[model samples]
Target: MRILICHNRYRQRGGENLIVDSEKAMLSERGVEVIEYVRDNNEIDGYGLVKKAMLYFTTTWSKEAEREIRELCRKYKPDVAHFHNTLPLISPSAYYACKEERVTIVQTLHNYRFLCPGALLLREGGICEECIEGDFRPALRHRCYRASYIQTRAVVRMLKKHRQMGTYEKMIDLYIALTEFVRTKFIEGGIPPEKIVVKPNFLRNPPDPKYGGDYAVYVGRLSPEKGVDVLLNAWKKIKRFQLKVVGDGPQRAQLESMRVENVEFVGAVPQEDVYSFILGARFVLFPSVWYETFGTVMIEAFACGKPVVASNLGSMAEIVKDKETGFLFTAGDPDDLAARVKLLIDDPTLAIELGRNARAEFDAKYTAEKSYERLMGIYASVIREKETV
Candidate 1:
C-alpha cells in the first residue's frame, strides 16, 4: 500500500510532528510505501511585513501548495492522501488537489481548528465553544489566535471559505480523531458521524515498568492552558512529596517567580531526560484546564508504570480511569489536585497497585503492534469504500 502524508511542521517541535514522524516510520517498517510532503513554519521567519501580509490573505487558498500537490499526485498516483496540519502554509486547497486527482483523502483532526478559529476551543483560561456551531465573528471579536485580530481574521476567513466550498464536507473521505471525546466534538461541530473514526496515538517502544520513586512529575508545556499555576498551588499544600516540572513555555518565568516550596522547575529537557523523570516519579501530573484532544503524557506515564493525577476533563478523564489507572482531580481546582496527590503519597502501596494497572492498560491498548493493526484496518476500509463509489 502507498500513502501520501502531508504536514506543516510547527516552528517548535511538538507532539503532532512527533506522531507524524512515528507513524511514517511505522508504516515504512511494515513494508508500506510512504511519501511525505512537508512544510515548516520556520520559513515564515524570513518573510518581510508585506510578504507576511500576503501570506495571511493567501492562507485561505494556497495556490502554490495546490499546484505542488497536484503535480505530486499525478506523478505518484497514491492510494491515499493523508493530511496532518495545513494552516498558513499548505491550505485547504490541497484537499481539492487530491480530490481532482481521484485519490482518497484522510485528515487527522488533531485539534478543533475546523470548528474554532482558535483551534484550541479555549479562551480566557476556560473552555469556549462560542464558535463551534456558530460563525467566526466571535473569534474575530476575541482575537483568539495570537491575540491579534488580523491573524485571527485570517484563520476565520480560511474556515469560512472552506465551509462554503464544502472542502471539509465533501472533499475528505475520512477523519481520524484521536479519542472518542474528540470524535464526538467534531460531530457536534459539523462532521458526519459515520465519516469519523477514533484512533489513539501509540508508543513505538515503551520503557520497562518500574515500581517506586521519590518525586511527582509534570511533563508538558508550562502554559496557562496546561494549568501549571494550579499545579504550583497544589504543590504548596503537599509537604511529603517533591514536584518536578519537566517542560518550559512562555509562562515559565512567571511560574518561577511564585517560588512555591518543594517544587523544582527542570525546564525543557531532551526526550531521554523526560523518560528518566517519568521513570523516577511516584505519579505523573497533568492539570490541564482545557479539553485536550488527547493526553499523550498519560499514556507515556502508563508505559513507565507510573499512574497519573490528571484533571477530570475531556480526554484525560476518558483515558485515565479514576482510582484505576490513575486519579482524577476537578479541573483547575488546586485543592482537589492536592487531595488526589495526597492519596497516593499517604499510601505508597496504592500507588504501586495503580502503576501496575496503568502498565496493564498500556499493554492492552497503546502498544505499537495494536495501533498498526487498527491503522491498517482504517486505511483498507477507506480504500474499499472509495472503490465502491
Candidate 2:
C-alpha cells in the first residue's frame, strides 16, 4: 500500500513532529511506500514584509499547497493522504486538493487547532472551551493566539473559512484522534461521530521496564499549561525523595527562580537521555492543566514501567488509571498532587505494583506493533469505504 504523509513541521520540534517521523518509519519498515510532503514553519523567518502580510490569506487557503499536493497525488497515485498538521503553512487547502484527486484523506488531530484559535483550548492557565461552541469571537476578544488580536484574528479566519466551506466535514475521509477524550471533543465541535477514530501515539523503541529508582521525574516542557509551578509546589510538600525535571521551556527562568527544595531542573535532555531519566524514576509527574490531545510522556513513563502521578483532567485522567497503572491528582491542585506522590513514597511496594501494571498497559495498547495494526486497519477501512463510494 502507498500513503502520502503530509506535515507542517513546527519551528520548535515537539512530540507531534516525532510521531509523524515515527509513523512514517513504521510504515516504511512494514514494506509500505511512504511519500512525504513536509514544510517547516521556520520558512516564515525568511518572508519579506509583503509576504508576511500575505500569510494571513495564505494561512486560510494556500494555493501553492493545493497545487503542489495535487501534483504529488497525480504523480504518486497514493491510496491515502494522511495529514499531521496544516496551519500557517500547508493550510486546509491541501484537503481540497486530496478531495479533487479522489484520494482518501486521513487527518490526525494532533492539537485543538481545528476547534480553538489557541489550538490548546486553553487560556489563562486553565481549560477554556468558549471557541468550541462554534464562535471564534471569544478568542478574538481575548487575543488568545500569541496575545495579539491580529494574530488571533488570522487563525480565527482560517478556522471559520474551513468550517464554513465544509472542509473538515466533507473533504476529510477520516480523522485520527489521539485519545478518546480528543475524539469526543471533535464530535462535540460538530465533526461526524463516525468519521473520527482513536489512536494513541506509540513508542517505537521502548526501553526495558525498571522496578525502582532514586527519584521521581517530570519529562515535558516547563510552561504554565504544563502546570510546572503546581509541580514545584507539590514537591515542596514532599521531603522524602528528590524530584528531577527533565525538560525546558518558556517558564524556565521563573521556575528556576522559585528554587523549590529537593527539585532538580535538569533542563532539556536528549530523547534517549529522557528515557533514561524515566527508567531511573520511581514515578513520573504530569501536571498539565489543559486538555492535552495526548500526553506522550505518560505512555513513555508507562513503557519504562514507572507509574505516573498525573492531573485528573482530560487525556491524563483517561490514560492513567487512578490506583491502577498510576495515580491521578486533582488538576491544578498542589496539595492533591503532593498527597498522591506521598502515597508512592510511603509505600514503595505499591509503587512497584503500579509500575508493573503500567508496563502491562503499554504492552497491551501503546507499542509500535499495536499502533501499526490499528493504523493499517483504519487505512484499509477508509480505502474500502472510499472505493465503494
Error of 2 at 193 (Å): 0.3
Please give the lDDT score for candidate 2: 0.93
For candidate 2, write residues 240-313 as lDDT tens digits: 69999999999999999998888888988888898899999999999999999998999999999999999999
Q: What tens-digit string does per-residue lDDT give for candidate 1 at 1-389?
A: 99999999998777898889989998999999998899999999998989888987779988999999999999999999999999889999999999999999999988999999888899999999999985999999999998999999899989998898888989999999999999999999999999999999988878999977889999998889999999999888996689999899999999999989888899999876788999999999999999899978899999999999999999999999999999999999999999999999998899999999999999999998999999889999999998998
Query: How many residue pairs clash in each candidate at the backbone level?
Result: 0, 0
Backbone clash pairs in model 2 (N, Cα, C under 3 Å; residues 3+ apart or in different chains), count: 0
Off by over 4 Å in 1: none
The deviation in Å at residue 369 for candidate 2 is 0.7
Judge candidate 1 against the unseen true structure and give its global Cα lDDT, from 0 to 1: 0.92
